[model samples]
Target: MSDSTAIFDTLKAAIAAEEPVALATVVEGPGTGAKLLLHIDQTAGSLGNPDLDRVVSRDIAGELAAGRTGVRHYGPNGEAREEAVSVFIESFAPPPQMIIFGAVDFTAALVRVAKVLGYRVTVCDARPVFATTQRFPGADVVAVKWPNDLLDEIGHSLGQRDAVCVLTHDNKFDVPAVTGALATGVGYIGVMGSRKTHDNRTVRLREAGVTDEQLAKLMSPIGLDIGARTPEETAVSICAEIIALRTGRDAPTLTAGVGPIHR
Candidate 1:
Protein backbone atom coordinates (compact mmCIF):
# COMPACT_ATOMS: atom_id res chain seq x y z
CA MET A 1 0.00 0.00 0.00
CA SER A 2 1.03 3.63 -0.44
CA ASP A 3 2.29 5.84 2.44
CA SER A 4 -0.95 7.84 2.48
CA THR A 5 -2.99 4.64 2.57
CA ALA A 6 -0.89 3.28 5.42
CA ILE A 7 -1.34 6.54 7.38
CA PHE A 8 -5.08 6.42 6.73
CA ASP A 9 -5.27 2.84 8.06
CA THR A 10 -3.37 3.79 11.20
CA LEU A 11 -5.60 6.78 11.87
CA LYS A 12 -8.73 4.68 11.32
CA ALA A 13 -7.56 2.07 13.82
CA ALA A 14 -6.58 4.67 16.42
CA ILE A 15 -9.92 6.42 16.14
CA ALA A 16 -11.77 3.09 16.39
CA ALA A 17 -9.82 2.17 19.54
CA GLU A 18 -10.32 5.64 21.02
CA GLU A 19 -6.58 6.15 21.04
CA PRO A 20 -5.11 9.61 20.35
CA VAL A 21 -3.30 10.03 17.03
CA ALA A 22 -2.68 12.65 14.38
CA LEU A 23 -2.09 12.75 10.63
CA ALA A 24 0.05 15.32 8.86
CA THR A 25 -0.60 15.73 5.15
CA VAL A 26 1.41 17.74 2.68
CA VAL A 27 -1.45 19.80 1.32
CA GLU A 28 0.73 22.10 -0.80
CA GLY A 29 4.31 21.22 -1.83
CA PRO A 30 6.41 18.84 -3.89
CA GLY A 31 5.03 15.91 -1.84
CA THR A 32 1.29 16.54 -1.77
CA GLY A 33 0.24 12.99 -0.84
CA ALA A 34 3.16 12.62 1.61
CA LYS A 35 1.87 11.95 5.11
CA LEU A 36 3.00 11.22 8.67
CA LEU A 37 1.14 9.48 11.52
CA LEU A 38 2.04 10.22 15.11
CA HIS A 39 1.00 9.04 18.55
CA ILE A 40 2.16 10.34 21.90
CA ASP A 41 5.25 8.12 22.27
CA GLN A 42 5.34 6.38 18.93
CA THR A 43 5.54 7.20 15.26
CA ALA A 44 4.07 5.09 12.45
CA GLY A 45 4.63 6.00 8.79
CA SER A 46 6.68 9.02 7.69
CA LEU A 47 6.75 12.18 5.54
CA GLY A 48 9.65 11.09 3.24
CA ASN A 49 12.53 12.91 4.99
CA PRO A 50 13.53 11.70 8.46
CA ASP A 51 14.00 15.29 9.69
CA LEU A 52 10.69 16.39 8.18
CA ASP A 53 8.89 13.44 9.76
CA ARG A 54 10.39 14.15 13.22
CA VAL A 55 9.58 17.86 13.12
CA VAL A 56 6.06 17.48 11.73
CA SER A 57 5.23 14.64 14.14
CA ARG A 58 6.17 16.77 17.17
CA ASP A 59 4.04 19.69 15.99
CA ILE A 60 1.15 17.31 15.19
CA ALA A 61 1.14 16.02 18.78
CA GLY A 62 0.65 19.57 20.02
CA GLU A 63 -2.27 20.01 17.67
CA LEU A 64 -3.76 16.78 19.02
CA ALA A 65 -3.73 18.16 22.57
CA ALA A 66 -5.86 21.12 21.46
CA GLY A 67 -8.05 18.82 19.29
CA ARG A 68 -7.38 20.93 16.24
CA THR A 69 -7.35 20.07 12.52
CA GLY A 70 -6.01 22.50 9.95
CA VAL A 71 -3.39 23.25 7.40
CA ARG A 72 0.08 24.57 8.17
CA HIS A 73 3.07 25.71 6.14
CA TYR A 74 6.53 24.10 6.28
CA GLY A 75 9.61 24.12 4.11
CA PRO A 76 10.69 21.02 2.15
CA ASN A 77 13.44 20.37 4.69
CA GLY A 78 10.85 21.25 7.41
CA GLU A 79 12.43 24.68 7.89
CA ALA A 80 10.50 27.87 8.73
CA ARG A 81 9.38 30.11 5.84
CA GLU A 82 10.47 29.42 2.22
CA GLU A 83 7.03 27.82 1.71
CA ALA A 84 8.47 24.65 0.21
CA VAL A 85 5.62 22.56 1.71
CA SER A 86 2.24 23.03 3.37
CA VAL A 87 1.07 20.34 5.80
CA PHE A 88 -2.47 19.78 6.98
CA ILE A 89 -2.23 18.38 10.51
CA GLU A 90 -5.38 16.52 11.39
CA SER A 91 -5.60 15.55 15.07
CA PHE A 92 -7.70 12.64 16.18
CA ALA A 93 -7.26 13.11 19.88
CA PRO A 94 -8.92 10.44 21.95
CA PRO A 95 -12.54 11.52 21.83
CA PRO A 96 -13.40 13.92 24.63
CA GLN A 97 -15.37 12.11 27.32
CA MET A 98 -18.89 12.87 28.56
CA ILE A 99 -19.25 11.02 31.83
CA ILE A 100 -22.92 10.97 32.78
CA PHE A 101 -23.40 10.04 36.44
CA GLY A 102 -26.87 8.71 36.06
CA ALA A 103 -28.62 5.98 34.04
CA VAL A 104 -32.06 7.47 33.83
CA ASP A 105 -34.21 8.35 30.80
CA PHE A 106 -32.40 11.63 30.60
CA THR A 107 -29.13 9.76 30.73
CA ALA A 108 -30.06 7.68 27.69
CA ALA A 109 -31.08 10.77 25.75
CA LEU A 110 -27.97 12.61 26.83
CA VAL A 111 -25.82 9.63 25.86
CA ARG A 112 -27.31 9.65 22.38
CA VAL A 113 -26.65 13.35 22.00
CA ALA A 114 -23.17 13.02 23.45
CA LYS A 115 -22.38 10.28 20.95
CA VAL A 116 -23.64 12.55 18.18
CA LEU A 117 -21.19 15.18 19.44
CA GLY A 118 -18.35 12.55 19.12
CA TYR A 119 -17.77 12.21 22.87
CA ARG A 120 -16.55 8.99 24.39
CA VAL A 121 -19.54 8.71 26.74
CA THR A 122 -19.73 6.70 29.92
CA VAL A 123 -22.94 6.01 31.83
CA CYS A 124 -22.16 5.43 35.50
CA ASP A 125 -24.57 4.55 38.29
CA ALA A 126 -24.41 2.66 41.59
CA ARG A 127 -27.23 0.38 40.48
CA PRO A 128 -26.00 -2.33 38.17
CA VAL A 129 -29.32 -2.95 36.44
CA PHE A 130 -29.98 0.69 35.63
CA ALA A 131 -26.42 1.26 34.42
CA THR A 132 -26.43 -1.72 32.08
CA THR A 133 -25.36 -1.35 28.46
CA GLN A 134 -28.89 -2.19 27.40
CA ARG A 135 -30.17 1.01 28.94
CA PHE A 136 -27.51 3.17 27.30
CA PRO A 137 -26.53 1.60 24.03
CA GLY A 138 -24.94 4.78 22.80
CA ALA A 139 -22.53 5.03 25.75
CA ASP A 140 -18.98 3.91 25.16
CA VAL A 141 -18.90 2.42 28.65
CA VAL A 142 -21.81 1.49 30.91
CA ALA A 143 -20.17 1.48 34.32
CA VAL A 144 -21.91 0.09 37.40
CA LYS A 145 -19.90 1.81 40.06
CA TRP A 146 -20.04 4.64 42.56
CA PRO A 147 -19.51 8.05 40.98
CA ASN A 148 -16.67 9.04 43.29
CA ASP A 149 -14.80 5.79 42.81
CA LEU A 150 -15.15 6.00 39.05
CA LEU A 151 -13.90 9.57 39.09
CA ASP A 152 -10.99 8.67 41.33
CA GLU A 153 -9.91 6.06 38.83
CA ILE A 154 -10.24 8.11 35.63
CA GLY A 155 -10.56 11.69 36.85
CA HIS A 156 -7.04 12.55 35.85
CA SER A 157 -7.96 11.77 32.26
CA LEU A 158 -10.74 14.34 32.32
CA GLY A 159 -9.23 17.52 30.91
CA GLN A 160 -10.37 20.71 29.19
CA ARG A 161 -12.00 18.80 26.32
CA ASP A 162 -14.02 16.51 28.61
CA ALA A 163 -17.34 17.09 30.43
CA VAL A 164 -18.98 15.65 33.52
CA CYS A 165 -22.78 15.77 33.62
CA VAL A 166 -24.39 14.89 36.94
CA LEU A 167 -27.78 13.78 35.72
CA THR A 168 -28.56 11.96 38.93
CA HIS A 169 -30.92 14.49 40.51
CA ASP A 170 -30.77 12.51 43.72
CA ASN A 171 -28.55 14.27 46.18
CA LYS A 172 -26.98 10.97 47.24
CA PHE A 173 -25.38 10.52 43.84
CA ASP A 174 -25.05 14.06 42.54
CA VAL A 175 -23.34 15.56 45.58
CA PRO A 176 -20.40 13.17 45.51
CA ALA A 177 -20.27 13.15 41.70
CA VAL A 178 -20.12 16.93 41.49
CA THR A 179 -17.52 17.12 44.27
CA GLY A 180 -15.32 14.49 42.62
CA ALA A 181 -15.65 16.03 39.18
CA LEU A 182 -14.66 19.44 40.51
CA ALA A 183 -11.60 17.94 42.18
CA THR A 184 -10.36 17.17 38.69
CA GLY A 185 -9.66 19.96 36.17
CA VAL A 186 -12.44 18.86 33.81
CA GLY A 187 -13.63 21.71 31.61
CA TYR A 188 -17.40 21.45 32.06
CA ILE A 189 -19.37 20.10 35.03
CA GLY A 190 -23.14 20.34 34.54
CA VAL A 191 -25.60 19.34 37.24
CA MET A 192 -29.19 18.51 36.34
CA GLY A 193 -32.07 19.70 38.60
CA SER A 194 -34.75 22.30 39.12
CA ARG A 195 -34.03 25.71 40.68
CA LYS A 196 -35.11 24.48 44.09
CA THR A 197 -33.13 21.29 43.70
CA HIS A 198 -30.08 23.29 42.73
CA ASP A 199 -30.49 25.52 45.78
CA ASN A 200 -30.53 22.49 48.06
CA ARG A 201 -27.54 21.03 46.24
CA THR A 202 -25.60 24.27 46.72
CA VAL A 203 -26.06 24.05 50.47
CA ARG A 204 -25.15 20.38 50.54
CA LEU A 205 -22.15 20.86 48.27
CA ARG A 206 -20.83 23.76 50.37
CA GLU A 207 -21.36 21.75 53.53
CA ALA A 208 -19.39 19.01 51.80
CA GLY A 209 -16.54 21.54 51.33
CA VAL A 210 -16.98 22.62 47.71
CA THR A 211 -15.41 26.05 47.48
CA ASP A 212 -16.84 29.21 45.87
CA GLU A 213 -14.42 29.01 42.97
CA GLN A 214 -15.24 25.35 42.44
CA LEU A 215 -18.95 26.06 42.58
CA ALA A 216 -18.56 28.66 39.84
CA LYS A 217 -17.27 25.90 37.54
CA LEU A 218 -20.61 24.17 37.59
CA MET A 219 -23.47 24.80 35.17
CA SER A 220 -26.19 24.02 37.66
CA PRO A 221 -29.68 23.21 36.37
CA ILE A 222 -27.60 21.76 33.52
CA GLY A 223 -29.17 22.89 30.24
CA LEU A 224 -30.01 26.18 28.60
CA ASP A 225 -33.42 27.72 29.27
CA ILE A 226 -34.85 26.45 26.03
CA GLY A 227 -38.30 25.59 27.46
CA ALA A 228 -37.56 21.94 26.71
CA ARG A 229 -39.81 19.56 28.63
CA THR A 230 -39.03 16.21 27.02
CA PRO A 231 -35.94 14.19 27.73
CA GLU A 232 -34.65 14.40 24.12
CA GLU A 233 -35.21 18.14 23.90
CA THR A 234 -33.63 18.60 27.30
CA ALA A 235 -30.65 16.59 26.08
CA VAL A 236 -30.28 18.94 23.11
CA SER A 237 -30.40 21.94 25.44
CA ILE A 238 -27.76 20.41 27.69
CA CYS A 239 -25.39 19.56 24.80
CA ALA A 240 -25.99 23.02 23.30
CA GLU A 241 -25.07 24.57 26.66
CA ILE A 242 -21.82 22.58 26.73
CA ILE A 243 -20.93 23.82 23.22
CA ALA A 244 -21.87 27.38 24.16
CA LEU A 245 -19.75 27.16 27.28
CA ARG A 246 -16.76 26.00 25.25
CA THR A 247 -17.22 28.67 22.57
CA GLY A 248 -18.07 31.43 25.09
CA ARG A 249 -21.13 32.29 23.03
CA ASP A 250 -24.44 33.65 24.28
CA ALA A 251 -26.99 30.84 23.93
CA PRO A 252 -29.75 32.73 22.19
CA THR A 253 -32.37 31.41 19.81
CA LEU A 254 -31.14 31.91 16.28
CA THR A 255 -34.70 32.64 15.21
CA ALA A 256 -34.80 35.73 17.41
CA GLY A 257 -31.63 37.28 15.91
CA VAL A 258 -30.38 38.11 12.44
CA GLY A 259 -26.74 37.73 11.37
CA PRO A 260 -24.50 35.23 9.64
CA ILE A 261 -25.53 31.85 11.09
CA HIS A 262 -21.91 31.11 11.77
CA ARG A 263 -18.91 33.32 12.45
Candidate 2:
Protein backbone atom coordinates (compact mmCIF):
# COMPACT_ATOMS: atom_id res chain seq x y z
CA MET A 1 0.00 0.00 0.00
CA SER A 2 3.07 2.28 0.24
CA ASP A 3 3.92 4.69 -2.57
CA SER A 4 7.21 2.90 -3.19
CA THR A 5 5.40 -0.41 -3.54
CA ALA A 6 2.89 1.06 -5.97
CA ILE A 7 5.70 2.63 -7.99
CA PHE A 8 7.54 -0.67 -8.13
CA ASP A 9 4.39 -2.46 -9.30
CA THR A 10 3.80 0.15 -11.98
CA LEU A 11 7.35 -0.17 -13.23
CA LYS A 12 6.99 -3.91 -13.49
CA ALA A 13 3.73 -3.57 -15.41
CA ALA A 14 5.29 -1.12 -17.85
CA ILE A 15 8.26 -3.37 -18.55
CA ALA A 16 6.02 -6.40 -18.98
CA ALA A 17 3.79 -4.52 -21.39
CA GLU A 18 6.76 -3.28 -23.41
CA GLU A 19 5.86 0.36 -22.80
CA PRO A 20 8.45 3.14 -22.75
CA VAL A 21 9.49 3.76 -19.17
CA ALA A 22 12.34 5.12 -17.09
CA LEU A 23 13.53 4.91 -13.51
CA ALA A 24 15.42 7.70 -11.80
CA THR A 25 17.42 6.96 -8.68
CA VAL A 26 18.96 9.57 -6.45
CA VAL A 27 22.32 7.89 -6.51
CA GLU A 28 24.32 10.83 -5.14
CA GLY A 29 21.99 13.38 -3.67
CA PRO A 30 20.34 14.67 -0.52
CA GLY A 31 17.85 11.82 -0.81
CA THR A 32 20.04 8.91 -1.79
CA GLY A 33 18.15 5.70 -2.74
CA ALA A 34 14.97 7.64 -3.55
CA LYS A 35 13.34 6.30 -6.69
CA LEU A 36 10.91 7.73 -9.23
CA LEU A 37 9.15 5.62 -11.80
CA LEU A 38 8.46 7.47 -15.05
CA HIS A 39 6.60 6.66 -18.19
CA ILE A 40 4.46 8.57 -20.68
CA ASP A 41 1.38 7.98 -18.51
CA GLN A 42 2.70 7.68 -14.98
CA THR A 43 5.08 9.31 -12.51
CA ALA A 44 5.56 8.15 -8.95
CA GLY A 45 7.82 8.68 -5.92
CA SER A 46 10.06 11.72 -5.46
CA LEU A 47 13.61 12.88 -4.73
CA GLY A 48 12.87 14.40 -1.27
CA ASN A 49 11.97 17.80 -2.72
CA PRO A 50 9.02 18.95 -4.87
CA ASP A 51 11.21 21.20 -6.98
CA LEU A 52 13.73 18.45 -7.58
CA ASP A 53 10.97 16.04 -8.64
CA ARG A 54 9.46 18.60 -11.01
CA VAL A 55 12.76 19.38 -12.71
CA VAL A 56 13.88 15.77 -12.96
CA SER A 57 10.41 14.85 -14.24
CA ARG A 58 10.78 17.32 -17.09
CA ASP A 59 14.26 16.07 -17.92
CA ILE A 60 13.17 12.44 -17.84
CA ALA A 61 10.66 13.20 -20.61
CA GLY A 62 13.39 14.05 -23.09
CA GLU A 63 15.40 11.02 -22.05
CA LEU A 64 12.46 8.67 -22.44
CA ALA A 65 11.50 10.16 -25.78
CA ALA A 66 14.98 9.57 -27.12
CA GLY A 67 15.53 6.24 -25.33
CA ARG A 68 18.59 7.59 -23.54
CA THR A 69 19.99 6.67 -20.16
CA GLY A 70 22.60 8.38 -18.01
CA VAL A 71 23.20 10.42 -14.95
CA ARG A 72 22.02 14.02 -14.59
CA HIS A 73 22.93 16.46 -11.84
CA TYR A 74 20.89 19.17 -10.23
CA GLY A 75 20.80 21.36 -7.16
CA PRO A 76 18.91 20.10 -4.13
CA ASN A 77 16.09 22.44 -5.12
CA GLY A 78 16.53 21.65 -8.83
CA GLU A 79 18.69 24.66 -9.73
CA ALA A 80 20.83 24.41 -12.87
CA ARG A 81 24.62 23.84 -12.94
CA GLU A 82 24.64 22.44 -9.44
CA GLU A 83 25.66 18.94 -8.39
CA ALA A 84 23.74 18.82 -5.15
CA VAL A 85 21.82 15.86 -6.53
CA SER A 86 22.81 13.11 -8.96
CA VAL A 87 19.87 11.26 -10.45
CA PHE A 88 20.81 8.30 -12.58
CA ILE A 89 18.04 7.79 -15.10
CA GLU A 90 17.58 4.47 -16.84
CA SER A 91 15.24 4.27 -19.86
CA PHE A 92 13.42 1.24 -21.23
CA ALA A 93 11.97 2.21 -24.58
CA PRO A 94 9.67 0.12 -26.70
CA PRO A 95 10.41 -0.61 -30.32
CA PRO A 96 10.09 2.44 -32.53
CA GLN A 97 6.93 2.62 -34.64
CA MET A 98 6.24 3.23 -38.32
CA ILE A 99 2.85 3.84 -39.91
CA ILE A 100 2.71 3.71 -43.68
CA PHE A 101 -0.38 5.11 -45.38
CA GLY A 102 -1.14 3.42 -48.68
CA ALA A 103 -1.63 -0.18 -49.80
CA VAL A 104 0.48 -0.08 -52.91
CA ASP A 105 3.35 -2.34 -53.90
CA PHE A 106 5.74 -0.13 -51.99
CA THR A 107 3.70 -0.57 -48.85
CA ALA A 108 4.49 -4.26 -48.60
CA ALA A 109 8.14 -3.68 -49.25
CA LEU A 110 8.29 -0.85 -46.73
CA VAL A 111 6.53 -2.98 -44.15
CA ARG A 112 9.09 -5.72 -44.60
CA VAL A 113 11.99 -3.33 -44.31
CA ALA A 114 10.53 -1.58 -41.31
CA LYS A 115 10.00 -4.87 -39.53
CA VAL A 116 13.58 -5.91 -40.17
CA LEU A 117 14.67 -2.59 -38.72
CA GLY A 118 12.78 -3.38 -35.47
CA TYR A 119 9.87 -1.06 -36.11
CA ARG A 120 6.33 -1.88 -35.09
CA VAL A 121 4.91 -1.30 -38.55
CA THR A 122 1.31 -0.45 -39.32
CA VAL A 123 -0.21 -0.24 -42.80
CA CYS A 124 -3.22 2.03 -43.21
CA ASP A 125 -5.46 2.57 -46.21
CA ALA A 126 -9.01 3.75 -46.77
CA ARG A 127 -9.59 1.00 -49.26
CA PRO A 128 -10.34 -2.12 -47.29
CA VAL A 129 -9.79 -4.32 -50.29
CA PHE A 130 -6.21 -3.16 -50.52
CA ALA A 131 -5.47 -2.84 -46.82
CA THR A 132 -5.48 -6.41 -45.60
CA THR A 133 -3.26 -8.42 -43.33
CA GLN A 134 -2.85 -10.97 -46.10
CA ARG A 135 -1.08 -8.39 -48.25
CA PHE A 136 1.13 -6.97 -45.53
CA PRO A 137 1.98 -9.96 -43.41
CA GLY A 138 5.05 -8.26 -42.05
CA ALA A 139 3.08 -5.34 -40.68
CA ASP A 140 1.94 -5.54 -37.07
CA VAL A 141 -1.36 -3.94 -37.99
CA VAL A 142 -3.33 -3.29 -41.19
CA ALA A 143 -5.71 -0.42 -40.55
CA VAL A 144 -8.58 0.10 -42.95
CA LYS A 145 -9.54 3.70 -42.46
CA TRP A 146 -9.14 7.13 -43.97
CA PRO A 147 -5.69 8.60 -43.46
CA ASN A 148 -6.83 11.45 -41.22
CA ASP A 149 -9.18 9.26 -39.23
CA LEU A 150 -6.47 6.70 -38.55
CA LEU A 151 -3.93 9.34 -37.61
CA ASP A 152 -6.41 11.02 -35.31
CA GLU A 153 -6.88 7.74 -33.46
CA ILE A 154 -3.20 6.83 -32.96
CA GLY A 155 -1.33 10.09 -33.43
CA HIS A 156 -1.20 10.70 -29.71
CA SER A 157 1.07 7.68 -29.28
CA LEU A 158 3.49 8.71 -32.03
CA GLY A 159 6.63 10.29 -30.60
CA GLN A 160 10.12 11.28 -31.71
CA ARG A 161 10.99 7.60 -32.18
CA ASP A 162 8.02 7.02 -34.46
CA ALA A 163 7.55 7.76 -38.17
CA VAL A 164 4.78 8.27 -40.69
CA CYS A 165 5.16 7.51 -44.37
CA VAL A 166 2.54 8.51 -46.93
CA LEU A 167 2.84 6.50 -50.10
CA THR A 168 -0.70 6.72 -51.43
CA HIS A 169 0.47 8.77 -54.41
CA ASP A 170 -3.08 10.15 -54.70
CA ASN A 171 -3.59 13.76 -53.65
CA LYS A 172 -6.77 12.80 -51.85
CA PHE A 173 -4.86 10.43 -49.59
CA ASP A 174 -1.41 12.06 -49.54
CA VAL A 175 -2.65 15.49 -48.46
CA PRO A 176 -4.61 14.25 -45.48
CA ALA A 177 -1.92 11.78 -44.55
CA VAL A 178 0.80 14.42 -44.55
CA THR A 179 -1.37 16.92 -42.68
CA GLY A 180 -2.31 14.44 -40.00
CA ALA A 181 1.26 13.26 -39.58
CA LEU A 182 2.36 16.87 -39.17
CA ALA A 183 -0.13 17.26 -36.35
CA THR A 184 1.69 14.54 -34.41
CA GLY A 185 5.13 14.49 -32.78
CA VAL A 186 6.40 11.78 -35.12
CA GLY A 187 10.06 12.37 -35.96
CA TYR A 188 9.89 11.40 -39.64
CA ILE A 189 7.26 12.26 -42.22
CA GLY A 190 7.97 11.03 -45.74
CA VAL A 191 5.65 11.09 -48.73
CA MET A 192 6.22 9.09 -51.85
CA GLY A 193 5.76 10.82 -55.21
CA SER A 194 7.56 11.94 -58.33
CA ARG A 195 9.05 15.42 -58.59
CA LYS A 196 6.04 16.63 -60.59
CA THR A 197 3.70 14.88 -58.23
CA HIS A 198 5.46 16.44 -55.28
CA ASP A 199 5.00 19.95 -56.71
CA ASN A 200 1.33 19.37 -57.50
CA ARG A 201 0.72 17.81 -54.11
CA THR A 202 2.31 20.79 -52.41
CA VAL A 203 -0.30 23.09 -53.92
CA ARG A 204 -3.07 20.73 -52.87
CA LEU A 205 -1.63 20.43 -49.38
CA ARG A 206 -1.40 24.20 -49.03
CA GLU A 207 -4.97 24.57 -50.15
CA ALA A 208 -5.93 22.01 -47.52
CA GLY A 209 -4.59 24.40 -44.86
CA VAL A 210 -1.15 22.81 -44.44
CA THR A 211 1.26 25.63 -43.65
CA ASP A 212 4.76 26.14 -45.01
CA GLU A 213 6.24 25.37 -41.58
CA GLN A 214 4.41 22.06 -41.48
CA LEU A 215 5.49 21.36 -45.06
CA ALA A 216 9.09 21.74 -43.93
CA LYS A 217 8.70 18.54 -41.91
CA LEU A 218 7.76 16.58 -44.96
CA MET A 219 10.30 14.65 -47.02
CA SER A 220 8.52 14.44 -50.33
CA PRO A 221 9.78 12.13 -53.04
CA ILE A 222 10.45 10.20 -49.87
CA GLY A 223 13.66 8.20 -49.58
CA LEU A 224 17.38 8.58 -49.85
CA ASP A 225 18.81 9.53 -53.26
CA ILE A 226 20.12 6.03 -53.76
CA GLY A 227 18.94 5.60 -57.34
CA ALA A 228 16.35 3.06 -56.25
CA ARG A 229 14.27 1.75 -59.14
CA THR A 230 12.39 -1.09 -57.46
CA PRO A 231 9.92 -1.28 -54.60
CA GLU A 232 12.32 -3.14 -52.27
CA GLU A 233 15.17 -0.79 -53.10
CA THR A 234 12.95 2.19 -52.48
CA ALA A 235 11.91 0.71 -49.15
CA VAL A 236 15.54 0.42 -48.13
CA SER A 237 16.08 4.03 -49.10
CA ILE A 238 13.03 5.11 -47.14
CA CYS A 239 14.09 3.23 -44.01
CA ALA A 240 17.61 4.54 -44.38
CA GLU A 241 16.29 8.07 -44.52
CA ILE A 242 14.19 7.42 -41.42
CA ILE A 243 17.24 6.20 -39.49
CA ALA A 244 19.26 9.14 -40.70
CA LEU A 245 16.63 11.61 -39.56
CA ARG A 246 16.27 10.04 -36.12
CA THR A 247 20.04 10.10 -35.64
CA GLY A 248 20.37 13.67 -37.01
CA ARG A 249 22.81 12.42 -39.58
CA ASP A 250 23.39 14.03 -42.96
CA ALA A 251 21.95 11.90 -45.73
CA PRO A 252 21.35 12.06 -49.45
CA THR A 253 17.62 12.48 -49.16
CA LEU A 254 15.77 13.16 -52.40
CA THR A 255 14.35 16.37 -50.99
CA ALA A 256 17.85 17.88 -50.96
CA GLY A 257 17.88 18.02 -54.77
CA VAL A 258 15.24 18.81 -57.36
CA GLY A 259 14.38 17.32 -60.75
CA PRO A 260 12.86 14.03 -61.84
CA ILE A 261 12.67 11.68 -58.85
CA HIS A 262 14.14 8.87 -60.89
CA ARG A 263 17.35 10.73 -61.35
In order of appearance, the predictions have TM-scores of 0.90, 0.75
Q: How many backbone clashes does candidate 1 have?
A: 0
Q: For candidate 1, which ten residues in a row score worst on lDDT?
A: 254-263
Residues 101-199 of candidate 2: C-alpha lDDT, one tens digit per residue: 999999999999898898999999999899999999889999999999998899999988899999999998998899889989999999999998999
TM-score of 2: 0.75
Q: Which stretches of candidate 2 lie above 4 Å from their native place?
A: 1-13, 23-66, 71-88
Model 1 steric clash pairs: none
How accurate locally is residue 30 in candidate 1, as Cα lDDT from 0 to 100?
81
Candidate 1, residue 203: CA error in Å? Answer: 0.7
Deviation (Å) of 45 in candidate 2: 12
lDDT digits (tens) for residues 140-213 of candidate 1: 89999999999999999899889999989999999999999998989999898867778799999999999998
